[model samples]
Target: MKDDDTRIKFDSEEELIDYYCSKPHPKAFTPSIVIVMLLCSLVGGIIGMELIVKFGLSTNSSIIGALIAVIVGMLPMKFARKFRNIHTQNLVETAISCATFGAGNVLMVCVSIIWVFNKPEMCTGILIGGVIAFVVDITMMYWLFDTPLMGADEAWPIGIATAETILAAAEMGKKAKLLIGGIAGGIIGTWLGLPMDIIGVCGLGNIFALTAFCIGLIMNGYWPTWFGYSLGDYYVPQGVMVGAGMVGLIQAIILIVRKYKGRSKTETPKEELKTADSTFIEPEESELTVEQENELLGEKDEKTGHIYTRTTKQMTQTFVRGIILYIIGAVIMALIGGIAAEMSEGMLVVWVIYAMAAALISEILVGISAMHSGYFPAMATVIIFLVFGIFIGFPPHALAFLAGYTACTGPAFADMGYDLKAGWILRGRGRHVKFELEGRRQQYYAELFGAAVAVVLVFIFYRSYFLAGRIPPVASVYKATIDAGVNGTVLRQILLFAIVGAVLQLISGLKRQIGILFAAGLLITNPIAGVAGLIFLTFRYFIEKKFGDEGRKNLNVVSAGLIAGAALFSFCTNTFKLVSTNSKKG
Candidate 1:
């Protein structure tokens, strides 16, 4: 082997720092990122709770509500001309939004527990738990604040600061201090929230959103300390109220701090400031080459006489196409959900059908976006959820929630595509995006790998003198619902009809709506589901026209973020459960 010194090279300190700053790392600023994610979980929890209480929704509705809130929150940024200009600032904002969503979800869980138990004191316990969680999260964030990984970028500081504010608010016992902390947390949260929002809305599936929610749940004392003491068993209504109150306190403090800090910060040098205003500086003329400018504007090189500019009209056309696809996809999704709900006797089958449909929809959208603009995939996914939710007897608010959540996935998937495209655009290493795609393809296989490894490990442990029989299969909400007998036959029939319709449409070259109608006829036995389908269809018709050109551009990032956040949240939650279970047993 070559000597170890052979691989070593020296560089100037400045050069090394510049190099380090330019590169992204898996673990860099991870703690800050985790904190920001926790905050997002809190927000999600809170939104989930509010939906349940205000709208009298279920878990499904709460999820949908959070999804809707995320989409609504993302809209302003989507339309703003300056949104993309400040990438770092956007990153910070998105992080904050994610944190808020997470916080909301936690609050929702607490409230739900309270409602279930019908105990007033449970609220107090929840409040204490929330405070404790906030303190732990914030303290950990602060402790890791000065690490080089957290200091290398503008986004990191904002994320860290937001977490810090949340900690401060939770720890502050005085009413005034608590008020101040809440205000500060909100402002900072808002500031840091945008990036995550963007990611959640525009990305196809969010890995972060779910992960953050799960982590926050654990940190906030939602995860059961004992296997037999599951979260569902121990959660009380009072605990939820107290948690909400604590959250409110933190939000107030954050807002107050922001208000006071705003005055003094205005006097600082413009260059030194790290607000959204300062971060999104316009790109200089030098940054764009003649070729790049032509590419961006769809202009052509004079000598080559090739037109490179993609007109606003062309972009609009692409947007319209995406919307159309989305509508069609939605119809298909609704039909599937309805059929599954109707046909299967087993609840597990229903969930499996739903997951399969979602996975298929996601994959199809991804493929379609690859062939066109990135927005189509996410739009398609959202439309699918909305159409199905309404058509299959979901409540109006539930439909709205589904629409929002589904819509969010569009952006998440689009982002994955965009990231791939960015690699193409920037001539970066080809492996990053390619690897990502491959990873997605092999995800199921990876689970199998993990299972196999786990089995082997268990066998080894048993043989090595540890007292062990076979590990029991892990129980989950899905399993419980399955046991409850949620049927999927109706949903399956609907999906089959949809497939038939699509096939017919392809063969006869008929309008796509014909396929939707066919699927609807076969699957939608419930009036509620039918109403949802009609509502979404009507909305799609108007909005499709209204969006014209703007929606096309806006849909890409926003939808990507939504999807990414949802997926992230789900994945994280599952991972947490796995970790907790495994850790406990070990």
Candidate 2:
């Protein structure tokens, strides 16, 4: 093998950076990753549905699924000598969104329709509502985030932090290696069909959601295509899991026999650690100080030394197009409702006007909120929807459409704004989020694919979960709120706050004032992240006190490991539970 250790090696860090950053990897956001993402999403949807039905919990599903997806999606990069950091981020983004949408949106919403309103018959209405929400949200994202807010580099603190984390992990430091170990553990668990019940014994719930899915399979006494693209569907031999129990049993016995015959072996700890250190991956340094590179493509204001991302005319054009789309979408919803959903034109007009107002105003607030807090103000959005619904008299289909539209759109805008800002942070471009327009176009393409797939998955899951009789209490409550009788007083109060908030935001733009107050207030509202931040800071402080500045620096590397560890724990536990349940059933 020509002495593998001496075959090739970089002499210095600068040479290493040049080698990796010279060209991008080809594995990002391709069909291969897309398939992996879809499979994860299917599993996530099933797990989320399982939790909701069994324990009325779904909040942690998105985060857990996203983390796992990140690990699996990045596994290929472990072997790629030319892998780029941002490409790994893209794979994570694509896979995580699928998992999130599958469980968080589709199954949960379906459960709400059936359980909350006792209206499983309103399936069509649900789809309509989701479509309208998606459309409005996409429009709001384009108008509020990518254009005017591109100049607002610090708009999303969380995105910036996340991008930094990804880059830090890419350096293949101790933290990155730990994260990789966690990912390996997770893959092992999945392959072995492990169960996650151990965590549940300690009241740590939702760790074993998909783990028991095989039990669901066993009870079916059959497998159907309607179950979606399950892992076993294509991966299992004999074309199905129907009789795989016997095969597993035989393999288990063989493994037992092998274990008895084979002696245990272990590598020397010192040598393994030495090898690990020698193989550590390092990332290119693309981040630049302002003085290093100032020829960025964004325009600068000559008089004030300020950067203007886009012209006022461009922003104006974006707003006009968004408004036009909003109006047309509403008209289409109304027309569709008239034909099949029993929505009157007058009611539709009322809902559309209210949706337009709510979407426009809340888009700004949500975008601003995202910039300052590292979160989208989802609660505020629901309140906005409810308040607007009260003003519109809560007409059936119109109420559904408006509620879904406003509640969903603002948060979408917030995510887009944050992600764009994150991209800028990672790519280190002052004027643009990406150097290549193709990357931007790819984002749009991936977004459309994800969105379209989400709607379809939602539709499929709506049927599946509804048939399974899983009703979402929160979703039902929200749905009932939409279907409830209106109170005029509530409308007055909402309007009062809305008008005041709008005026404040508008005035702040001219004076550049609200960013500070809004940022401060936003941080205050996020007690969980705030407390979490304090804990991390305290931990870091103690490390510095004990070991000086070097320990503080190492914390950056360790953070990624912790994230991957958490994800690995979840994956192993979940898979363990599945294997246990499946074995028992078999």
Lowest summed lDDT across 10 adjacent residues in model 2 is found at 198-207
Scored by CA lDDT, what does every candidate get? 0.29, 0.43
lDDT of 1 at 418: 28
Q: Estimated TM-score per prediction? A: 0.24, 0.60
lDDT of 2: 0.43
Error of 2 at 244 (Å): 58
**Runs in model 2 with CA error above 4 Å?**
1-21, 24-31, 44-89, 106-121, 135-146, 150-152, 155-158, 174-297, 301-312, 337-344, 360-364, 416-422, 429-436, 480-586
Q: On residues 1-586, what C-alpha lDDT tens digit does candidate 1 reach at each position?
A: 1212212122322232223223432221234433332343344333332333333221211222222323333344433222111121222233333223222222233222222332333333332332222222222222211111111111211122222222222222332253343333333433443323222221222122222222223322423443535322222211222222223323423533443455343223223322323222222447556533332332222233322122223323433443344444333433433422333345334433443344334333332222221122233233344334434544332233233223223222222222222212121111222222222222222212222222232223322221232211111221222223323653444354444434432332211122222222222122322333233334434554798665432333233323333334433444455457668979
lDDT of 1 at 13: 23
Q: What tens-digit string does per-residue lDDT give for candidate 2 at 445-553?
A: 4444545555665667666666666565556556666666546554444344334334433444412323222322331222323333434445555776898776644
